[model samples]
Target: MDGLPTRESSPGVVVLPGNRAELVAIVRALAASGVPFVARGAGTGLSGGALADSDSVLITLTRLTRILSIDPIRRRAVLEPGVVNARLSEAVLPYGLAYVPDPSSQTACTIGGNVAENAGGPHCLKYGVTTNHVVALEVILPEGEIVRLGSHAGEPW
Candidate 1:
């Protein structure tokens, strides 16, 4: 999500994909048709980047909130973009782990939005920002290609 804020604006289309495959297909079709679109995760962005304009398609990712995997030993979790920040920490609490970047909006903001904003809060001074903790990503490109990048191992950032 990266664009101007639109309050009270009506979008031409609003899509909520239930799964990754459906999301990919929608993006592919939109790209091929040359339709302008914006993707959003949880719609809790303070930057107003998630708001959609009248002519563009708004792809809301709220339905994609699944924490796919959690490796407590590695301190890494694979989650859909819409999973709330605090939820991740809560999920890992039983494992004696916590997601450290405690943004003020953590209770409402999603991990994807935090990644987009490189979000940090009071813990940043001691723990660093989101990038420092994120090891890898499975990204869907603007043209609808799914590509996995980076090593899910040791790293400074």
Candidate 2:
């Protein structure tokens, strides 16, 4: 892992937000303080997408692991960024539902990372990648403003 081509400099600070409010606050404070920051998930991505250089702060989403809501009838689920990719499927298995993005690192990768990388795996040949399964996204802008992209109704905004 350390020898991966995508590996970069180490981060100076690391923070894990327990919830949405805390995540927002941290982003706000970091922005106001003029410190660079990068959002990171399971850190299992082969592309080094989660790497943060020394000048940046690493905001790990591990603590935000929660399946916020699920609508079996709609086949939609709202989850925190830290939720593991495989866990989502496990959670909805009883409802005969599953998230379709099956990244190779599914067991350890987080939904946020899957979204960031638009990850794909063996099943992608039939199911498509993360972007195909993602119906919406609730994201915090660099300035600390939060906004929703796309909608639960499966419409992109």
Best by TM-score: 2
Q: Write the per-residue lDDT of candidate 1 for residues 30-135, one digit (tens) a residue.
A: 9999998888876666677777788899998878899999999888899998899999999999999989998888898889888877888899999998888788
For each of the candidates, the C-alpha root-mean-square deviation to the true structure, in angstroms, is 2.5, 1.7
Alpha carbon lDDT of each predicted model: 0.85, 0.86
Candidate 1 Cα deviation (angstroms), residue 31: 0.3
> Which RMSD does model 2 reach against the true structure?
1.7
Q: Write the per-residue lDDT of candidate 2 for residues 20-123, one digit (tens) a residue.
A: 99999999999999999989888888777678888899999988998989989888899999999999989999998878788777888899988998988888
Clashing pairs in 2: none
For model 2, the superposed segments whose C-alpha errors exceed 4 Å read 1-6
Query: Model 2's lDDT to the true fold?
Result: 0.86
Name the 10 consecutive residues with the lowest summed lDDT in model 2: 1-10
